[model samples]
Target chain A: MSEIVLSMKGVEKVFGAFRALGPLDLDLRAGERLGIIGPNGSGKTTLINCITGVYRPDRGSIHFQGRDISHIEAHRRARLGISRSFQIPRPFNGMTVLENLLVPLDYCHIDGSKEERARSVLTSVGLAGRISHPSESLSQLELRKLELARALVGDPKVLIADEAMAGLSEGEIDEVLAILLALNRSGVAVIMIEHIMHAVMRFSERIVCFETGRLIASGTSAEIAENPLVRRVYFGE
Target chain B: MFSIDILLNAIVTGILLGSVYASLALGLAITFGILHIPNIAHPTLVVAGAFFVYTLAQWGLDPIVAAVIGLVPFYVLGLALYLFYSRVFERRGGANVLQSLTLFFGLSLVVEILLVLSFGSELKSVNVSYIGSSLKFGALTVPYRLLIPALLGPVMIAAVWLYLSRTNSGTAIRAVAHEERALSIAGLDPAAVKRHAFGIATATAVVAGAALIMIGPVEPFGGRFQIGRVFAIVVLAGMGSIPGNLVIAIVIGVAEALVASYLNPSWSPGVAFAILLLGLAFRPQGLFGAAR
Candidate 1:
């Protein structure tokens, strides 16, 4: 059996009397491809935020690689191999593509020639041709790829891709999906929080659905597609 | 009448003076330009730096050497100041921009008062050997006092520019201002980067102070005269362009020198603002700033 790389036990977050997430239990096995889907404001991002240490969970414990990391800072979490790509794509403007990747490579203290690692990651994400190009000059697809390359440059154990393909067309979506899949094949766990139905369904091995800050459904892709609660949350039938 | 020698002298003096202006604005270029902190206290800090050099010079050290020695202390002072600013304004429920400006403005006043208390409001200048000399070309002569200190501006500016553009940590500093959250996501502490940047900015003040003392005497409130000009350079240069900072400083300096020579000396102070307004009217994002 695969080891449980990340486990959340009865986690909860509250913001100004609003229950943002949890009283929930979730787990991602090592090398697992998990999909998280819900309507907007249904706690998917909140859950990811808690996991990434953007917001400390008001109550609950988060364990990564058997170490409790509930109170660690966001950067510490990234250093410990938990990383994510933002949904809206926040590339460091006024910098070149290579420089953007160097931020992560520099901070993570990745064991390498940082320049070589940055180039390797850029090449992996198919951004090698544009390494010297300014970040603001990149197209939407290139920007998304740059975002993923930054996330991957840290060589994370678990990658939470938050809507990483929101604005891409079908072909562009395929390009990104291939990159994420290739990343997973190299022994990294992936949590795909996405709104695109076909992409999430296709990419995830096990899928989970959320509604009003509660985990409504969890199972294999085939089982989740037919789950009644998830169906109700999505189609409101 | 406008004599050629006077005109040429004004232009040459303007260039030298502008370089000195660049040294003064270098710190603000980081604090206000790149970090966007609106650190109005920077000029006062430069005044403090001059005092540090002055105190050292009282013991018979060269002002330039004294400033070099003062760099680390000034950097630490910057770190402490940034920490105080962060704690009082940033960490205390995230103060609004106006509130931060007020904090910095109030800080400048406090620093000025403190200097007055410590130094007794007397004008202070360093007794360097080169102060009594000038380098005479065929038709023009430049004072060594101004020339040496003026040279400090470009040298330090180039050093800072290289550090920011070349090093790994420097890249983090550049990235933190815009992609702070992304920087954190990339496993860097954004606060730490800014604090270091603030330290670098503050360290420049000592060097600027060294230059200021060489150019002329400085009182506790001497910074009051320079507040307008430094801010103008930072804005006109574009928020974070190091080379642009030097260029704009020279433009304002030459304009001021010409105004002071041809018109009233009082008209020189407004020269920076006039150019700033004119520069902004055409290039609102600044001359070198990328349009956002």
Candidate 2:
């Protein structure tokens, strides 16, 4: 079995009267491409938030590389090699695209020249030409790419791409998928939280489905596709 | 009708006065403008800084030299204050805006009282040989004290602008205002960045204080009159725009000088507000601010 990069055992999150996620256990292995799919408000975002340390789990523990990191702050977790892109891209305005990449590189204290690292990351995301352009001027496709680039700039071990391709066109979606696939091939693990069915199915080596914050099914794409519970909750069939 | 010679002198004097205003407003630009902290205590802190310079000046140190020496302690003070503020209000995610304002307001009052107790609230002035002199160029005569402080504004602004644009920590400070989460995700502690930025802002107070005392005498409550005027400069400069801050300060200075010459000298205090209101009514993003 591959080494587990991230493990959450019996994690839970509650908001006021509502239990947003868990009493759940999930594991992501090194270099794994895992997809989490659920309907809107099915706790996909809550789970991501829990993992990224935005919202600490109300119960249970999260272990990264076999150490309990349940109480670690979000930035500490990010420095320890977990990074995520936002559902709605939050680019720092009043900055050039190159400067956006430089922020993460600078904050993370990654050794090497920041400008060089930013240039390389921008190149990897096919945004090398737009380096000097203002981020506010970027198109939708460029914004999505910039989001992914920001997440990837830290050289994260596990990247939680939250709805990265949500509003993109078909061609744009494929472009992003190609980037993710390329990233996975380079030994980085990815946890994609997406609503788009085929893309997730095509990309994920393992798939998990959530309904009302509870995991109803987990399997390969074919197995999840055939799972009657997943169909009933997802398609209402 | 305005005489040409009087108008020219007023314009020159306004430029000089504007430079001093820019220095006074610089710290606020960082605290309230860039960090979004609404540090209402900033002017009072400037007064405190003047006291620091005054005490140091008694030891035969130049005001500028004393201000440089005073920067370290003020920075540490700012860092501690921000840490306290973040713990009490920011981390809790409750009533941050109103609570922070009240906290700083109370802090300002406390600082004022402390200054009064320590210095006896008497008007204090820094004495230097050059202060009594003036430079005469043809029909223009500029007082050395005003010219020296005026020069400090551009120098300080240039240094601050370069730091903000050219360095890594400076970039983080710029980004911290826009999105805390973004900074966190980038592997930086948002609170730490804010604390550092606050320290830099507070460090600026000493320099501003030096300039303030150089321009004239300062008492514990002297900052009270400047509260509205300094804020007007920051807002008119468009929040955190450093270079813009200097330009707007000069413009307001010129207007105030013109008003004092042609209109009523008493009305000069109101000139900044008048221009501020008019500026906001037209280009609300400020002269240099990008459209949000």
Candidate 3:
């Protein structure tokens, strides 16, 4: 019902002899919360990589904000407002928390002072107190927060968070979920690829399940929970 | 027994020598330390820069003035080299260590051969008014050549350090080595950052070349002898630590001077490696670098 911010048509990604993902189609609407789930190596990462321009899909095309971006470079895609957080936090270890945010802000050429913007992002992520702390010194929770802050600093239109809550405690999971939810509420379309079932279910407005590079089911959370194909592939019934 | 005056003079000379060493190693600090490019051909490039300066000196230009003028073309050459390297190696999932080493080694040989063919195998030196002068301070004598080149190192280092610490492009360069994807996802092209960095690295070679020829005559293959010492300086300085490069270079220079004066002059060449081996064994993160 909403405007399509990102659309993928017949996308396929092959790794030598293996088909890593696609020969399928997907779309993300503007200001929508879409959740994707699959078991280990189920092409979830491949899909995200395709959309973020990390991997050039072997076939088909991707359109973002009505412009074809399948052949665009990853950084240019980011400048066009496509940003993501890695499954494992990959903060620039040599930099401070403030410096980490500054990289994206500076690269994106965002308006206003970089320090003020970095400080504001840090503050939003509840990391205002540790602005000058080196990224290597952060705890697990803070590292996760810093990763999110780095992604958010770009002012991305579409934020693909890949397993961002992995390895966190229930409380930490809740915290990150809240951040993503707040970000979505601010009109940014979010694609959450998470293994935390309860968190994804609670955050997603709609859910899509992937199995071996194909979308097996797409529906509301309740319909997906009741879908037999999703149960079989996700729960291995 | 070593006289107090002799010891003082050796230390002072060592410091001066170390400063020049820092200039030579600055490019490596960027290419190897920051960009993680194992450009073993860096010293060869410095020799090329020296030769370029030498040719220009014939036209009545000061070596330093020629070096400053030469930064532009050398930077463009660096960009082209990085592009060539990335296209051949980095673009296809990155080159392994041995492959990159081999490529750079071959490139160095090519550069040396070119230098030989063009300039002949004979030694070349830059003739400047200050070349034959020295500033005497009591028992200590600082040659104008050594003092001039030595001063260039700290000035360059300070300027580069400020650029790295206080600028956005500089921060992106530092971050590129750590997580290139982080840079990309932040809307900056990682390859472009590396290309720029490589250009900066190569540009430093011009000034360093000027400094080298100021110290003494340079032959086509003069860079070969410096390979080990320069690498030792970069690694011992904690990879990308710009300030650390100067300090470690000075330390190695002083140690080498001490060996030449109190120990054996023949043993002076081994000082860098000895310190490098010790640093790797004891503090692999380097003197100023944090644990990886």
In model 1, which regions exceed 4 Å deviation? none
Clashing pairs in 1: none
Candidate 2: segments with Cα more than 4 A from true spot: A109-111
Tell me how each candidate scores on DockQ against the true complex: 0.89, 0.81, 0.84
Top DockQ: which candidate number?
Answer: 1
lDDT of 1 at A123: 99
Clashes of each: 0, 0, 1
Cα RMSD for predicted model 3:
1.3
The sequence of per-residue lDDT tens digits that candidate 1 reaches over residues A187-223 is 9999999999899999999999998898989998889
Q: Is candidate 2 or candidate 3 better by lDDT?
A: 3
lDDT digits (tens) for residues A31-61 of candidate 3? 9999998888889999988998889999999
RMSDs, each prediction? Answer: 1.0, 1.1, 1.3
lDDT of 2 by residue, A1-237 (tens): 789999999999999999999889999999999999988888999998888888999999999989898999999999999999998889988889988888888756667887888899889989999999999999988999999999999899999999999988889889999999999999999999998899999999999999899898999999999999999987789
lDDT of 3 by residue, B24-101 (tens): 999999999999899999999999999999999999999999999999999999999999999999888899999999
Candidate 3 interface RMSD value: 0.8
By lDDT: ranked, best first: 1, 3, 2
Docking quality tier of model 3: high
Minimum summed lDDT over a 10-residue window in model 1 chain B is located at B88-97
